[model samples]
Every structure is written in C-alpha cells, then in structure tokens.
Target chain A: MSQHSIAIIGVGKIAVDQHLPVIAKNPAFRLAALVSQRGIEQAGVPTFRTPAELYAAMPDLDAVAICTPPSVRHQVALEALNAGMNVLLEKPPAPTVSELADLVRQAAARRCVLFATWHSQYNAGVEEAKKRLAGRKIASLAITWKEDVRRWHPGQEWIWQPGGFGVFDPGINALSILTEIAPEPFFVTAATLTYPANRDTPIAARLTFASDAGLPGAALTAEFDWRQTGDQTWTIEIVVEDGTRLTLIDGGSKLAINGNLTVAEPMAEYEGIYARFAGLLDRGESAVDAAPFHLVADAMVVGKRETTDAFEW
Target chain B: MSQHSIAIIGVGKIAVDQHLPVIAKNPAFRLAALVSQRGIEQAGVPTFRTPAELYAAMPDLDAVAICTPPSVRHQVALEALNAGMNVLLEKPPAPTVSELADLVRQAAARRCVLFATWHSQYNAGVEEAKKRLAGRKIASLAITWKEDVRRWHPGQEWIWQPGGFGVFDPGINALSILTEIAPEPFFVTAATLTYPANRDTPIAARLTFASDAGLPGAALTAEFDWRQTGDQTWTIEIVVEDGTRLTLIDGGSKLAINGNLTVAEPMAEYEGIYARFAGLLDRGESAVDAAPFHLVADAMVVGKRETTDAFEW
Candidate 1:
C-alpha cells in the first residue's frame, strides 16, 4: 500500500497527454516503467520493449496501465494478470468483446484487479446527471459526437488502422458517457455507419437505441462523425416526461436544463478514472463495462451496407 | 422435476420451428403456456397475450424461455427471473452485452437460474472438435457463414433491425463455435463490412482476428455474407503448425483433418445446449459464454465501416 507501483504498456499520445500527468498528481500510484515497441519516453519513465521483458525484469510492479490499440491490449493484459499484477486498461478493453471476456475470466481466475476505464464516464457532471436522471422517465434522447479527424487526431494513423475504431475511437467517448448516464437500459435499435471508402473504419455513423422493444415510445439516438466542419461537438440532450430537457456539452463537463445552467464544471475525466481505479484496486474488485463496446458491435451486427466515395487524406 | 413446466415468450418463427418440437422430444420439459403479443397455437397448452398475464395466471409454471429479438429479451428475462422462475434465454440474452451482464447478475441476486442458450454451441461435433483443438497451438482459422436471408428469414424485418445483429445473427453462431474451439482469446485486426443501402445493417462483412498484436503471419479471418446462392456454406477450418488443416461442417457435425476424415459426427446443436443448461441448473450454476457476442461487439467498435449496394428482397 506504500505505492501501487505501476508500469504502462503502449506509450503513445494518451500515455503522455493524460495518464502520466494523472499518475504524477495522484499519490496513490508510482510510475514504475513504460513498455512500448519503441520504448519511447512519455515524459521520461523506465522503458521496456515487450510485456515478457517488462514483467520478467520488474517483479515489484503491482499494476500496468495498458494504452495500446484494442487489438493488442488483451495479450498484454493477460500477461500482466498472469504475472499476478493488476491492470488498468484503456477504453474498449480489448480489440474485440470476445477478448475482453477472456481477460475478464482470466482476471477472475487469478483474483487480480482489472479495470476498464471509460474516461468519459468519469466526467465531473456524470455522477450528478446519473443521479438526477435515474427513475425519471425519458421521453427522447439525442447524442451528436462529431469531429474533424484531421484536427483532432492529427497524425495518429492507428485511428484509421484495422482495430483503430476510426470515428468510433472518439465516438466511444460519447457511448461511454451514454452508458453511464442513461436512466434505463437501452440497446441499438438501428444504425447507419458511413466509412471513408479508402479507410478501414467508419468516418461517420448514426445510431439509434430504445428502451425495451423501442416500445413505451422512449428512444435514444446518437450521431458520430469525423467530418464535422466547425466546432467539435460531443453532446447529449435528453427530454424527460416532465417536460424538462437536460443538455450535457463538452462530453459531460457542462450541463443545462431547459436552457438554464445547471452545472458548468471543468473536465476531470482521467482524474475521476484514476480515483475509481484506485478504489477498485483497494477493494480487491474488478470494474469492467462491456456495454459501450456492445452497442458499437450491435451497429456492425445489424447496420446495412453502404460504400461512400473514397477518402483521400 | 415433473416435466419442468416452461412457458415460451415472444413466440416467433424460431419457437414454432425449433423450440416446440425440441420440447416435445425432450420429455424433460413440458410446454405449459406461451406468451406473445399475438397468441400462437398448436395443441394442448393455452396461449396468453403477454408474459405478465401468463405468469400472473399460471402459478404452475416452473421455468420460462424468453425467445424474443435481442433488443428486448432482457426485460422478459428479468421479468421471468423476478417471478421466481428459472429462465432459458435465447442467444444474446439481451439486446446489449451490458444487459446480458445484468441478467447474469440478476439471476445470481435471485438465486434463480438464467440460461444464455447458444443453440449452435451445442452442435453434435463441437465438443469433439474442441477436445481435439485444445492445448494445440492454433495456426489460423477461417469461418464462412453465408445464407440466403430472403429464403430463411423471408419478411422478418426485425432481423435487420438494430440489435437484431444483421448477418451476425448467423455469424455469431460461427463465433460461438470458434470461441469454444480456440485455446486463447483473439481480437479483430481489420474488417470491411458491406451493407446494403436500403437496410440499416450490413449484408456482408470480412473480419479478421489474431492471437497476438495483429501479427502479420497467421490468424483467424471470419467472413460473413447474407448474399449466398445455391449451396450455403457454414464451416470452420483451422490450420495447425504441423501443416495439417482441420475443417468442421454443418456447424461442427463433421470434421476432417488434412484431407482425411478424422471425425464425422451427427448434428445435435439444440440438444447439446439443453443438456448443458440442464447440467448447469442441476449444479445451481451458470455457464455463460459472452465470448461470441464480445467478439462481434469489439469488431464493431474497432472495425472500419463501409457501405455496399442496396439489398433487395
């Protein structure tokens, strides 16, 4: 308990931009090492090239933060779990839901901690929104998450790679938030995804969900796009039966109801995530949510086919 | 247990064609009553307009099988569980993975059994195939699941509806088999989903998975298409390190390895599933495999999207 010494796999932008600073600020953790193919320094931590090498050398590390692409996180997580270390996995736990299940099973078998951190779920206003909306009958809900890929991702080619999740990479942030805030259980009712013909993933998508049979006349709809021209948007607005509308903007940091300001809080996504992870680790528990990924899968499982014009970056 | 009186919910085509006759043959379960929006009839048992009305009226019903579309199965399952009844839920268990988890959690909370039945996983040859493949390093896998939706599903529009899981409705059957046979978890590396313009879901998709980090050399590639003519294909072929190829036909009824028929078994998909469910119920335990659904979801979350030509009936 002195300090849960942790190493990080896949030292990429997120490792630098969010994870490192969060660890640095939190006294509950100590940055032990960073494992990546190139062994790059995300603000100067010890580096290891592969999971085997990292684990064999660092026997004292208690946990590992997996920041790799979804495709490879499972293998790394499995290794960490097998080596009797806890895991703090990034969103979309593994490249596929199946892999995540295996990881879950493995973690349970090993009695090691596994946390699937949906950063968006930790927004400052999320807990407040969830508490307020619970049991309140929802009339209609809409979420629009669109951003220009070039502006947001810059040179991150992995975003377009096979397991990169393309627009969904960012779109999942919205899904993570929705999964947390929805008062009732909802599933994808219908969806239309648009892919840049040349890319391996969708560039834009329209997703719809309903509360049980899409009956009761309650609905949830989401639009995720990487082609928005101006003003990056990540917002959710819900109209309840009582004739009040709740709007959460900048991905749950600010909120308004009926055009009146309710909560205008600052972003603390990663901070909240780390605090939650620490709690889980402290309690000998595992926190894994596969709902957000399941919705995305439902879209692929049910969505119709379309071929847009090829995109040339 | 006195014919294990069971009620069928959401009596659709699958119930009439598969569930009823199977129940009749089993002799272990008796079709006590059926609950559907539109009551269906055959012989013996009466039908109720809804699950609430049926369960309310029948105190003799010992178990319930909720066979609705994936989108709404969770509610019926939850309802059945709440009524102090063991539940046999069709594939999906619910519209979303999270819902499935909730059902799993709910059944535990109530101490009543909930069965997430994957009809295909019980295929006659699956166990034999799984035994043969276990512990052996899998080199690669190929799943080809193609059928004429118009012929099989006909005017059943709900199959293409979101949460209905489009081609994955069938493809997931393939995954159920793959997940059972494989030794380790695999993640989707790349995918191109082809959807028809008129529909909200994809008609065809190519999904690839790897045991490691999108390793270049060898892996499993699953191909699912709704547009098939003449002889339909549902098969899984595994390539091993010894240069031997193994194939299972009729969803694991027949198996052959390296040009020699290593095993050719009978089809018993439904019975196998029921047998396992019975065993689980006897042990007061749950055997749920979310691997198939997770794989599908992970692919959707990460796979790039594309749209193809419009599908016509």
Candidate 2:
C-alpha cells in the first residue's frame, strides 16, 4: 500500500496534542514536514518556519493538515490547493463562509481534495445519534456547552483574538453534533448573542432554529459560557416526539438515553477525522459541509447582541 | 391560456412603484388581491391585513408577490409557500441566507415555486455586458454602489433593523449582478462592514472577492455608502488585460467603456421581475439564488464591527 506523505501547518495546541499523536498512530499517513512560526522541537519531522519552505523541502508531501487559526486559514489553504496538494482543515473551516466557499471552488477547479472536518461529529455517540435521528421527527434540542477555556486552552491567546470565535470555540462542537443528528436541515429563526464588554466576539449565544415544516422545528438554544468554575458542562439534550431523549455528554464520548447509560468510548476525534479524510482521498471525493458553519453565520446576522461581563485571560 | 390571479403583499414603496404596476401590465398575472397592514390605496383590489389572512382568503390565488421588509419576509414566504402558491420575492430574498436555504428546501419539498429576483441585474445592459465579457480574461473589477437612503427610503426603519441588511440592502443588488455576470464563482476575500452606532445593522461595507483562477480573481471591491449626493452612483468597472475598463452604471441601466457611454433600454426592473416570475410559474420551475445573501451573512459574521456616525429619523 502506498502511503500518503503529509505536512502539518500551524503547529498550535491542536498540532501538538492531537494531530501529532493521531498521525503517529495512523500508518496510512507518513509525516513529511511541519511548518510553524515557532519551531517544534519534535525530532523525526523536518520543521520549517513557513508553509512555502515546507512544501519546497518536502516535495513528496501529498497532503497537508492545516491547524492554523481561522483568520489565516483561507490564504494558507488556497496556497496549498494551488500547489496541487490535498488539505485537511479544522472545524469552522475559515474565518468567513465566503472564504470557505472560495477555497471549495478553488479546490474544485484545481481538482484537489479538500476536507473540512468537524471533529466533534466523529465522537462515539454522534454517529449512533445520526443513525437514530434519520427520518425521525425531532421535537426539540437543548445544548449546554459551558467550558473552562483556561483549563482546556491554557495560554492560547489566539482563541480570544478577533477571528478566534471565542465561546463558539466550544459552541461549534455542539453545532457540528446538532447538524449531524438532526433529521431535517434547519436554520436560525432567531438568536441573541452575548459578547463580553471588552471582547471582540461573543462569550455566549442563544440560538433558535426552525425547520422547513415550521412545526416548531427542532428548536436549539445553546449557552456557551467559558467561565464555569467547577463541574464543567458539555452536554446536548435532544428530545424526540417519540419520548426518546438522547443526552450526549462528556464531550460526546458518553451517551445516555432516557437517563440510562449506553456508550463510553475513548475520544479519538482527530484520528477519526484523519481516517475520514483518507477515505475521501481513496474515493477521490471532497467532504465539505458548510451547513453547520452556515448556521453560525446566520445566527450571528439574525441574533441580537448584548453586552456581558468582560472576560480576561 | 388561463391568467393566474396573484396577490401583492406589503404594498410599500417598492410595491407601489414596481410590483403593482408590473402586475397590472403583465397579461399572465392578474392582480386579484393586495395585502398590507399599512393599507394600500390601490383601486379595484381587495386588501387584507396580514399574509396569513391573505393566504386564507385567497386559496385560489396562483401566485403571491412578497414586497415586505426583509425582517418578516421569511415568515410571509413560508406561509405563502405552505399554502401552495407560487412566490415572487424581492432582492436579498430572505433576511439571512440560512433562512433562504430553508425556504428553498420547503419550496422544493412542496413542489411550489419561489423566485428570488435581482432587479438591478434585470436592467437592460447587464445581459449585454455578460455577453461582451464572456470568455475574455477578466483581470479585475471594482463595483461602486452608493446611494442616498434619504432620497430613496426616507423613513424606512426596517433597513436599520438587524435583519434589514444595513447598507447591503443596495450592496446585495450589486452582488446579485456581479455573481450573475462573473465567469466563475467568487467568494469575499475580506470585508469591512461599518455599522452606525445607533443601528443594529451595518451602514456601509467594503467587500473584496476572489475567483478560482490565479488571475487575482477579478479584484471586485464593492463600496456601499449611503452618503452619496446627486446623480447617484451604481457603477461596476471591470478592468481587462489591455487596460480597457468596462463600467456598468445606473444599476446596469447603462454601460460605458473607457468613459464612453453605451446605450441601454429604459430601466423597468419590476416589469422584468414579474415577467420572470410568471415564466417560472408557467414552466413549473423555481429560481432561488442565495449566493449573494450568503456572502452578506458571512461578511457580517467575520467582519469586525466599527461604529460610525449615528443617524436620526
């Protein structure tokens, strides 16, 4: 079997914690090069300060994993796509959906595979929920994605930046799950976003969605608070009209139905993402799901903004 | 051939100036009903207070023209579509692109037709320009769409609302034209949307687009300013390789090449809109373009907020 040589760009927390470990375990992919402003001291991979040099040095690299911040992802991905390289992008693909759209179009024109992976959907319970929710009427949905950013991200300054998505940093995981489990496609009917007094982005948002049926359409109200002190919550409650309430918790590594525990799996979201990307490459297909990101953009547009307590790192 | 009876909803400025007259003139459509809370004074047509009552009263009405504000357009459209009536929607389609997507899905499921019209692009010179520019290498484009809101919509409060689309109310018209005429799909590379301090919507925006080709993607930057004085500019300049600049002005009602004027038929945007709606209904087809609105929503989400001057009624 021919192995695909891949390069890693923007060696941030994800690159260190997830991509490196996942690539290490996946035999289908060979680590070819790495690019970061700050050099990664990890041996065995050729490190470069920029993407262009990495691509030049590792001419055998077949694909690249882009773990950059959303703001610069579009330009970097465009460069990679233009150079005839397949791409694996993190969630919320680009800073703007238009940029993601541009990248998708560019990838199509260049005939290169582009993967916009929503890692949270690769959780153990998510696929089960997706299978269960298909063709089933969804009555309502409630997601609580409160997390301690300081605990998870430590000193990550980029998450609080203009394009970091702030609270949506965790909220998008819920959205990715919601997009996958919902039977019908939905859009935001109304929303209210709570931005910190001093922050550029919102710290929490309450979004309401309605489906085409307009039959009270699987309403989702999410609260993304980054200041939780104890017992951090990351739960999604989905109530179907058939008296089934599926609660996915612990960042979707666990699932309980009607208060009965059913699932527990080692969370290998990054690994699953790479596996999916490899499957897409094997099939010569592009996996680009803008639906979840589209809802985020729409919610931002329709949602009212309120000032909340200022957040500090 | 049976003439379809159509009802006109939200008989406001656009409805009075465009829709009513167009319905009156189009032989395929007969203006059988008028709907508005403000009470339109058009003679020989019955008026209803709301879209629900309008839909309830006129089950036999084959089609409906929605000229309501963008804020409530999706609800009115949903009701109209659910009642199995063809719809003719004004520019920007729905308040947000996600809502429009839902409407499109709904329209598809019910086998009803929904027409999202771009009145500016319907102007005479647009088709000619598209024909002229086809297959020619487009080096860059600059679209300047500035109009005084005071001159057009004096007391329109909805334009200042969150869903009202701020300066994009007119900018989207330019986007519709650009999206239609461009040889390939383009996405907003970067944008800066300026919101008035007192308003929830953006008052002006500078948007840039790039295409798939490395040709700098027709550097189309659209600036929508509500502060334009006299002669009102709505012009798009396309710069070709030979230094030839093709400008389409007056909302595409006229064209000019290198500062020289090109002829255009008299502008009758609404007339063409009704004609197309009728044609779609006649052919049992639906034409809904959410691309322009998608860009607007994406821009709104990613564009950093900068408060500008406050405005009064």
Which has the greatest TM-score?
Answer: 1
Q: Which residue pairs of candidate 2 clash?
A: none
Stretches off by above 4 angstroms in model 1 are: A39-45, A212-215, A239-245, A304-313, B10-13, B36-38, B69-72, B92-95, B146-166, B196-203, B212-219, B225-232, B239-245, B257-266, B301-313
List clash counts for every candidate, in order: 22, 0
Alpha-carbon RMSD to native, per candidate: 3.6, 4.1
lDDT of each residue in A64-174, candidate 2, tens digit only: 999987778888998998778999998779888768777888899898999999989999998888777788777777888887878987877766655567778788888
Q: What is the lDDT of residue B96 in candidate 1?
A: 67
CAPRI-style grade of the A/B interface in model 1: medium
**TM-score of the first chain alone, every candidate:** 0.94, 0.94
